[model samples]
Target: MNRRIVLSGTGLVSAYGSGVAPYWDGLCSGRGALGPARRFADAPGYRGEPVGEVPEFDPRGEPRKSAYARAALAEAQRSARLPVLPPGALVILVGQAPAPEGGGQLDGEEWELFGPSAELRPDGAAVLHLSHACASAAFAVALARTALAAGAAPLVAVVGASVLNRYEYASMDVVRAVARTAARPFDVDRDGISLGEGGGAVILETADRARERGLRADLTVAGAACRVGGKLPAASDPGAVTDCLRTALAEAGADRLDHVHAHATGTAQGDTAELAAVTAIAAELDTPEVPVTSHKGAIGHLLHISAVPALAAAALSLRTRIVPPTPGLTTPEPADRVHHPRAETPYPGLRVAAVNSFGFGGNNATVVLRRD
Candidate 1:
């Protein structure tokens, strides 16, 4: 179905802070989170600079032991502030793998070894795990929306989060090898992305339900599309990205994009290919100046959790009409998409914007968010 109604409210914790306010503030200002790399001190061959570290989260003292997923859920519930919400909403949790999965497998370890390390909540509700590479969060969002649309559930709590893992360095190295200086999407010097840890919680419900409950939201999830094309076979990059964008736009009733919050990971191949897709899509529009920016410099790529912060940032841009700057970008050109956020939004009434996320191998997902 093209219409899966958007309800309301969201909660997020990322490299910036444990709340949405701080994260939004940093997301909109073109902030840079690149700092000394300290997560993988014992590992070698991980000589990368600057990482986006989420503010300290000590769950051992005072409060209690809080897993990343649990903390995310709590913050989400607190932020949603939704009253009288459906109690049977399905909980879709992404990144449920063990801590060791990310740290590179030890000798003789199997798939189960790479799964989540946290103990399951004794009272955990019906939870579905999404293990999609970078597109995990968006995948959850799609499934949740579909569940709501199909009347299978009244609401769905979409949570995407990950703890600090040793493989972060391994992943960062893959990104760093491609990108060193900064996360400059479309830039000539574009390399790869920086790894960052993040947690996001979103409550998706029906419009009828939201109104009945008096829930308020800043935007609506007009529609979303996903394309798959693992790199193993022929690896069709352009084909996959274009199909996803086209389908998502068609479903959103949006042919023209006002602003595009890209999955600009700074990797030469990824950025260049994404730019190709962007330019192609933009070419079909009258306003091709949908200023784009990749927030990797501000907060390293949080694989499963990347889209939340980026999508949140896009909502702010559409609200304020300012496209944020690409932190490490000095020169903005054809190949460069990094830009600055104007003090006051130029177009205060911008409506629809696009957020792109493509994962390893070739998982492409594009979401269209319209101001409510």
Candidate 2:
């Protein structure tokens, strides 16, 4: 049986603030939240790059990642009206672990930071932790769809969180991937990525299960694809990304797309490569004027959990029939093939959207969401 997977609820915590309202508002406002680094401003390797730190977040006591994850999960549960995780529920935690020398991985000694503890997981619930760099959340969603199709669980909750720590900051600085100011995806003068910290969660269940629970099941996970392009950590293959997008659309049986949430992280190579793939996909779909946007310009790159916000944005676009604008895009690079909106655009026929997330090591993932 081909089980239909649907997105029942979504929760997000970004630099704008907690909840979907604030995040959506921030995106539509066409303004970025990136500012001076508050946590690592005085770090040894810090070069005064702006960051998208969560407002009023205190990293003094408990792990900031854990707190963000829990808050996002709580919001997701509330949105789904799931007071407690049901028996046999599957929880997928997505995050990247710090280097061994810098500190133990989040799933290792720092397991409590954002592990599937008793608080987040019930007695019969199963847990899966994914640390596949930036595409971790998209991979989790793909896995959740597979598991639901196989009847492994009635529903799946995917939660991901990442914070701007000194170690990661230093690593980014070393790679020169951190932008000097703010992220300007697809802009002619785009520099690099602006790091951001936050958590996001999305609840997925089979269509039958959602109907049983009396939850709205309009937003469906039409398709998903993950592809490994090359060995380089910071570089991506346009061909691989094109194949990934083609496969996702093929799986979704979609010939047209209403919106595209691209993984343009403001890096010259990354943005250009993604634009090439997106352009190819647009040409294939015969929708040369397809609207595309990137959340990184506003929220900064969320690293391992980047896909969550993109997925959230795509889903909300389907529901609201509005395409959110891309922030920090002043002079768009010459791309007449696609429309990059800098202001909120109404798409009355918005029914299908694709969210792309390309991680280090050429880990590229795409999720096609549809509204019935």
Candidate 3:
């Protein structure tokens, strides 16, 4: 029998604070955490837009990214009431490997910190790092589903982290991709992406195991699909994203989705391309227009493991039956099939919600989540 993969717990570290409550509260309040960049030493030299740096992060000695990952994982483990594994669980670290300057092989150290199970550490537990730009977190969920279905492990722990430092901020400046004003998804006057730093984690388990432990699953990983763009790191191909979404929805047996968590960075080309793909799918299926949202407008773009926080928010939406507003999404264009919500809209009977994540290397990943 095929086991259903479900999300059991969540952890988050963002500009708002270190736990899931702060992150979700910030979203529901419709107040963005974006402001002047203070985490970097070379902030004054940055000619780009304001950034949403995590507050009080003083990376004096440790790698900034590792600190973010550790906090998120700790909270996730605690929330899930994770017990010591008996040499059968898997740990997937969803983040880019450390840069050469930072250090070498820190993934293992991070995993050790997150998963303290000696039995699993010796042989059962292994760390896999994905560097698929922004889609890394979404890919982690897809991998967890595959592992659970194959019975490779009874539980899969996915933790993701990403940060914006001086080096990366300068890189975005060179390409003129940094937003001059604010991160506005699907808005007519939107300019570019406002880079941000944050990360989150989620614990996945089989439905049978969750029931055995008397845990209520917030959302199930129904289906997922991934695709890559061709020869362009800065551009998104609508056709590829469309194909990926189509495959994921079809696999999930969802002809219509209630909500869509779009990976819209607020860039002109990026937002337009993604919405076009979603529009095509909606038209092909003849489904009602789906309410779409992008958290980047509120938290800025959390590069690399951006999808982790998005997945957490999607799960929360499923649990609470409310979809938070995509702050700064005022005056959405009328041409797109996906409608940008203006407030914290209550979605009754939200069975399925689709999430899209696109990476710089043309990686497009779609995850379909269902409640009930």
- TM-score of candidate 1 against the unseen true structure: 0.84
Q: Which is the leading candidate under lDDT?
A: 2
Question: On lDDT, who's better, 1 or 3?
Answer: 3
Instruction: Name every residue pair that clashes in candidate 3.
Output: 229-362
How are the candidates ranked when ordered by lDDT, highest leading? 2, 3, 1
Candidate 1 per-residue C-alpha lDDT over 91-175 given as tens digits, one digit per residue, 9 for 90 to 100: 7767635344234644322321243333322233456777667787787787787788888876787766654555545654654
Measured over all alpha carbons after superposition, the RMSD of each candidate to the real structure, in angstroms, is 4.5, 3.1, 4.0
Q: Tally clashes: model 3.
A: 1
Which candidate, 2 or 3, has the higher TM-score?
2
How many residue pairs clash (N, CA or C atoms closer than 3 angstroms) in each of the candidate models, in the order given?
17, 0, 1
Q: What's the lDDT for all of these models?
A: 0.65, 0.83, 0.76
Regions of model 1 farther than 4 Å from truth = 1-4, 61-66, 83-85, 96-124, 171-178, 230-236, 333-345
Q: Distance from true position, residue 232, model 2, in Å?
A: 6.4
CA shift of 119, model 3, Å: 15
Candidate 3: tens digits of C-alpha lDDT, residues 1-372 = 448888877888888878888888888878888887664545544764667778876545555566677677778777777764336777777655533433335463343222112121325666666567778788888888998899988888777666776556666787888888878888888998888776677878888777776787647899999776654454378888888889999988887778888898888888888888888998887866777888898888887778877887888888888888887788886655677767778888787988899977788899999997
